[model samples]
Target: MNEIGGWRLSKKLGSGGNGIVRLAQKGEQKGAMKILRYDSPKARNRFHDEVMSMRLCADIPGVLPVLESQVDPDEPGQKWFVMGLVKLLTDQLSDRSGLRTVVQAFAAYAETLAAMHQLKVSHRDIKPDNLFFYDGGWAVGDFGLATFQGKKAVTGGGRKIGPIYYLAPEMLNDPGNADERCADVFSLAKSLWVIATGQHYPLPGSYDLDHSAFRIGSYLSGERGVIELDRLIASATAFEPSRRPSMKLVGEELRAWLAPNVEISMPTNIDFKEHIAAIEQWQHSRARAAKSQKVRDEAIRSLTNRLSDYLNSPLSNLKNLIEKSLGITTTINKNPKCGFLELRVEVPADQDRLAFIILILDLNCESFPAVNLQGRIILEWRNKAGFINLIWKRCYEFIENGADEPIKIDTLRAEMTEATLKALSETLSLIIPSHKIEHKPKLVRIKVHDEKGDMLSGVSLRFIDSEGITLAAAKTANGIVEVALPTLKNVVIFVAHGSFNSTVVTLPDENLLVVLNGDPRSRSMICGGSWVSLAGLKGELAFVHDEIEGGIHRLYVHLKELSGNSGAPGAVDLSIGKPVRLKDNAGRVAYMTPRAVIGDNYLIDFEHAGDL
Candidate 1:
């Protein structure tokens, strides 16, 4: 057994040219103890700088946190430091966790590295062993060769620091002129390559070791793995530092790959149970006083035909007016209870497509009694290069008649036609040359999953603008959907699969992973089957039945969080069912059952089925 300072070394972790690491223990706390091997001034200074760098990034979530440091009192020159001990990446790989876990771990690692770069420090060594699973997530360690931006080099020129397999070409060819941050990016990309493909390095004859160009495109272009991860690694490992994306961009890309769901909370003043009860009462009253089925069917058919004729005839004139004025071509299509118009505008000189205008008008007679008219107008445009772009969009709701006044379809149609023309004219004026715009199209990747973390294929994702206009829609291919929009404007994403309560997500600028509740095997099964109001709680608890595994039906209990000065609920003692628990990346307790108590274990009994 070896001992350094007050830490007792149990086993040798690893050794390198600069120092040796050992599993160290002090009282009950365990950590990694690194002992410097060289007594030279350069080596001593490098060790001191490493400690300083760690201290600088101590607050960052995923960067390894330093515990203690000291100079060997007896030797007067030797130095050592202790850091939080964590499981090796090899341990995770050995356990054979899913590919999603691997991607999530690397994504956290990238975010931590990017945070360090934001502080102007670069970790020159980013390889597999240096990354460890700490607090249930990945963290970066080993800053021995770390460099600070705008600071003089600590080591002499011509001495490359990282291993050859992971070294950036510039580090070998022109060490003096190489950008330390870019070199770190290159090394991280290589690390990701290893994680993605389980290979030591790029394929043996992929590219010359001396050449700066990286020829791992073939590996990156593979059909397996996440597409966004492939693109990010490719860009990070570009031949030139200028060509590589910034660490911030790398962090964003990684986060997009691990895409978490967009969180939605009920409004503060809304009581879900009370709202549902009110709606039920109103429905009962309406059902008691409704007309005969035959009479209702006849009325519905008449209204449908009237709406179809109005859109075909009156709306056509409005479409022609827009085309003649804007010098574009238009198409009209009928929707279930609405009408859709698409107008395409082209540049006169080049004949290249310039813009697209879409309009959706609600034609349901049922809604006319409450709100006379509702519609939306959207404008999408692209540069000379044909890409999807959005220039302007707006939703309109107008009441042409109050309870005292009867509704008139002709009057409503004429008024909407004028409003449509005005909106189109205003939109075209704001369409500037694409080259002059500063913001690029934002890429949004959506992955749909079930409660058990299994990906759902063929799910439909619809992108709706702020004004409730459907901009674009796509079905998931292999549980993933990727779309590019011209702007990072606020939008809502509506996800639908056979009858799983359609989930609505307010789209963020970043990518997303949407977890929905329905089981495809049973189309009639309602998500969160039914809500049971808790005795002393402000909100209800509902159980969503998941798949049956190992002869046990797994159910997720969702607890809606309380609002305002509502007191916290008591420990929910469910004697009827067994409770399940989950963990987050940091090993902190997280509840799969929404709004449940954190850090507390659960016990549930389901002996008496169908009884709350």
Candidate 2:
């Protein structure tokens, strides 16, 4: 026996390139001491990393602990650390050892690795020989290549670091930049395959299924498995590092292997009726999950187009409406800013991209998410989000967090249209001393009428200042809406109808006659699918689009002369995505631009679609 630090070293346990492990005993305590055999800088750094890493994981039940060590790796003579003596995990899952035992053991090992990962440590050199069973729990030992995430790499880049067979492809290909935690997950899973099959090691780049070992028990999967565990493992072992699950998720998945969705014993214990009810509930839950998954898949598929829909619809309307109604000439720079779908509205006022309204919707929302991607359809719309009081609303149409799922890009053009217009209006107002009307307010009567000189009822009117903010709003019942204002300079009034909103510049002293072009009773607040009388056309023209009746995707439209200018109602059909253009028999036109959320999930219906 050789004595050092009052501990007597006995039998040699193992030997590595730079160190040797020996059984050590100090009175009643027994441990394994690893002594450095070289004085190179690499060896010294390796020891330092090992000691520091072991110190961090000392309290975790599954990780091996260092009792005492030469903390300073540069110390003279032998650098050694003593750890609890445990048996190597090699051959623990021998052919005779049931797959049950292999599953139970590896599942716990997964938990241990998870604990290490939670601490941001990756035992980069994990292998069956590095794992040991002691104190009725498994402990992973050896931190020569262990990595502290986000820290400077101790070893040089571009070289394979771990054992060849258990090495993650990324570690083999790009060791320096490879995500250490994900690499560890790969190595651990590969090690599981090796042990479960009782093979010396797995064939590099080969799948577990390709090899044999009653590996089906290891194929364990469900909620975490869905055969889900199997899928998770598949993903964890995916060639791409990004595809792998985090250690925490892998650990949860491993534990889930032991849980049954419905215990087999439940039917035996519960009464017949209860058993039947349980089966029905279970079946319903599964069906619901499948249905939800289908909906989610369809929505995700629409994400790219939804992004385009935004640009073509609300954002397009915003630019046009601002120029026509608010008198602010603007342009939309449709290019992505920062790899994100950015809708930046610039006004001619500055002749530069002043960002009059910037809505940077995440093109890849999970990468560039929308409304926080879940429960609420939130808008972090440039600093102007707060100006429109009612612009923000819940995205119940997309995200449903009964349980939880990753947020998907499922927003529609119709869903965001009204909000976008209101926000644009409010935001544009901030730039308005353009109306330069400097006068005190006095009593004035604003008479509302359609383009035909017919008195228009139910027209909502707003009195705005030179600064472009609404000072007051009044709805008309007798064709006249009265408000007090000054008559010295010109006044700007906003006329609002359900589907039509216009900005009018007038003098407060004279009783102003405001002409609204579109119908006041539009079904949609954002557009006029409602009736409209064109300059040359006598009958009010529009279309009534029916909801989809079977699996049909085309829009079903019925053109009618509601006031009896009289031909029969013209029934026409249009495709789902293209803009709708309906021509009455008299050569009169009723054009409707669709605002439906069209995608893989559904081709939208026209109950409340389009503008005149």
Candidate 3:
């Protein structure tokens, strides 16, 4: 039996610690598929979480969609997920200076992180590889390592589970007690540093060092580039959890730095890292696109063979003999053998010459099951003498029951040759009238000439209109029509001729939508994370980074709002010129002297700083 689903697997794309990816397709839909190594509890749980988180963030432009997710009932330990295929940036971190591109790629990620934090959630792990781009936008992916703040992780056992290179100093010192949200900020900062510098953070073995020691040594040593970012990383990755800024603040700070220097022409919507990781995540989606293309190619080849056979047939000349004596033009129209069989013959100005014909062949063609043996078409024209005749024979089989063997090479070559002969013979039977035929104006025109090749005039067209309403429409002398639209937004046009329809759509603005007309498998984008604090403020500026069993952490104070003049309960318009430190979620302290000028409009409300 033939395969019910139209697909053929192509090749393997990639594999990783969790699963292997392959290219695949269903009908015309091409994408990638990921099959897990085993559906262990950990795998299944992670898979479930990934699907859920991806679905929640589906509106984010760069993130690929999860087409389907299935678990093997029998194996119980086998699972699979389908994802959109994307092109990947090859090892950009170790190679080129793509900081501008990197920022563009992670713009969407920043928005996502900010939104997530607003909802009181923490990704827990943020790194370069977990970001991806799709349709020119960025998204944060790999929620497998994510831990929602204020609550115990969905999966128990507090191991230092994130990538070591992006780990915060606090997580390195004591993994178990490290605050999830604060640690996420440090990791995000580390990622930014890598993208900006194309190198790892200052401390190479920081993940293995004591948190307290690494923080003091790395920050004071000044190994990382750009003094400002180095200091920001140091404060965000401080050994003490209380010293780290919130993810929201980190996003703000990163935006502040990038906004003034907007030299990046990239879309602020896509993530490129996620695209790379997705290639590492799912390979099946790629296979699907290949399979769909193969089917279409095969079908087209079959039609071409049939046409060639009719054109080369020896009996083709008989069609011309009948049309000349009748003093009329004959045109034969028939459906190809692919779908359904239809034959229509039109003779201008002669009722007897017109024919609506259908032909059926009883012979069993064993190879082509898609062809219908019971249906075929033939059109013939004859004069009063009836001795000399014009005949056109065309075959279209809509239903065929035959052997399911692959078509033989010899048979195809022979049939194709015969089809070519028949097509030529039939074309000669049609006689053009003295008047030329025009189909439309300023679009597509169907023209005709007489036996002497003299162009005919006063010929009108019968075709479909813009609304698909068929009518006797005429063309201008230039053979064109002005078909305007209701509005500029409706820039797309679709033309349908009988059974087939061709559509043309105008490209929308970049922010609106992107059409994937070609293979999406070879396309991809980079991914990155967002910062919480723009100016590196931590400790007292806390607004419930996450909920813990006992209480909240990443605490800070709003010094500007607290009235220090008379030691009374009052509020002050928080400013950013002087450095401020939030201490123990209980009070605020001066980190820098009043003489240190940062900027104005920096709201460090002593009472309302932790409003988040």
Candidate 4:
């Protein structure tokens, strides 16, 4: 079609069963437009349903806004709807190890679902594909299956409609009689399971009508990775509908489950077999080239001179290859109990290039693990390329090479350690630092003290500038000391004691006071859990988002501990205009106030709710 209504069709981005989504621009309005297939009545009806559904959810935080829509005049039987486009969040369940993105996205989705349920709406088709990640929250689509309380559904003669993977057992069997709310809950939990495991579904077959719940649960529960999520979803997808929890309860449980655990390893699609083959091929080509090449004395001298330049640079030895090899070695028969070890050696800064051997003696005889020697050694080096690059080298060879004698532990250990240390140091010297921009600091002040209220004496503090410069010096001031910090944007401050290190942040105009009040060994708080202990805070508090876990939520907390309001957590419903008092832990009334929007989210601001 050349044009629809007044807008010109740009290009097709994606398509579905009902319509093809196209990027469209009309006058000053720009958005993604979905056009229904002209021949299918079902598709047009589905498009209308989605338009109305998203329009109703526009007020919700995560749902996207439906800008406009109308029937296509050029093409009879076709309808078109325009809405804001959002970035698609693909299958990344494995990559999200720390659960930061997943948790934040899920929280917004949960809030949107809760808001929908409260408005007497049911999103029947709840699947990962239907969930569109947007700025504020997820935008749910495909509402052809949506059904209101007194209205007839568009599917199965107002019967049952939902993705088979997420459909509740009761919904499939009872259809009209089953509560749509519970079905949404089951779907949400099932969706979370997919996000956790990166699996296509609970089991491997087409939508089999005669599926057994026990079989499905057994399969899902036994899946590898994200064991916690697997078990939670397994429980939610129980055959007995009565056994399943409510959607709100499921959301709460999921939130709690994700709080403590952080996943580290994510799934990678890199082909290891192909990579190995390429490495082997490269080695063959390089060996052949080296054997056939005619080298001149000048070329040799140039290479040696470059190596000399690297050795004489003022960077870490670990970053240089030549300097690192000269200083460190890998030892086999070494002190096993040593938490850390250091060796001092001399290196000739004028050497052209020297190859150092590093040997790793694996104590655990069960398996041979590849040692990551990337940053283990440092060398001093300088480069003119405006950045530092690590001069790194490693070789995989048998401990005894081709020797026919069994190696002694002590001898092999000494040799390996010697070689490894030297090689690492040389590598360090070759490294080139990344490009950076340095800014002059303004000024900030930081304070620190010990539990006895005594000033901690002789503490070592390191200041990191925004341009990646780090300066460290011992605290000359006794227990009480003040450090004048340059006012640099996005700089970090690190504080360290005996074996423990803490990061305290310095914000412009905000005074930084750290008072160590409890036993260092205690993980649990000595006071109530009103505030997270300030000791373990690692510069994370400086940039807290509005929707973080510790945000101002309308929960049943003892407001009496706060000061003005003294009442049970559940005594009054905490809302926008609700009058409530807070009491501190010592039974003193805290500030009484109505809620207000602080940033993007709403929180209770302190004031007398009304005239005292």
Best by TM-score: 2
User: Which digits, one per residue and each the tens of the lDDT, describe model 1 over residues 240-352?
Assistant: 67556556556655555455545578667654543443343344335324546765566556555555565568667776776687666776776622243333333222234
Candidate 1 CA-lDDT value: 0.55
Residue-wise C-alpha lDDT for candidate 2, range 397-489, written one tens digit per residue:
111121112212334445455555655655444333346645555677788776778886777665654333446668888678888765434
Off by over 4 Å in 2: 91-97, 149-153, 206-229, 264-612
Ranking by TM-score: 2, 1, 4, 3
Model 4 lDDT per residue over 1-612, tens place:
857767778988788767788888888877788887655655555666677776666787767677778843335644888777766555333453444466455656666777787666788788888787665445665565676543322565344568888777766655665667667877877776566445566542222212233222223332222333433454455555544544554555446544544545759855453344334334433433332224323333443344234322322333254345433432322222211122222332222322222221122111111011111222211111111111222222111111111122223333444555545443434221123324554444456676656766555455544233453233525644455545444344444443222323322233555553323121111111233112322111110112223222222223211322333332344322223445434433323222221122112223311111
lDDT of 1 at 461: 67
| Residue pairs in collision within model 1 | 576-605, 576-606, 577-604, 577-605, 577-606, 578-604
lDDT (0 to 1) per candidate: 0.55, 0.54, 0.40, 0.44
Alpha-carbon runs more than 4 Å astray in model 4: 27-29, 39-44, 71-77, 91-100, 149-153, 157-160, 204-228, 258-612
TM-score of each: 0.41, 0.46, 0.37, 0.37
**Pairwise lDDT winner, candidates 2 and 4:** 2
RMSD values for the candidates in order, in angstroms, are 29.4, 22.0, 32.2, 23.2
Comparing candidate 1 with candidate 2, which one achieves the higher TM-score?
2
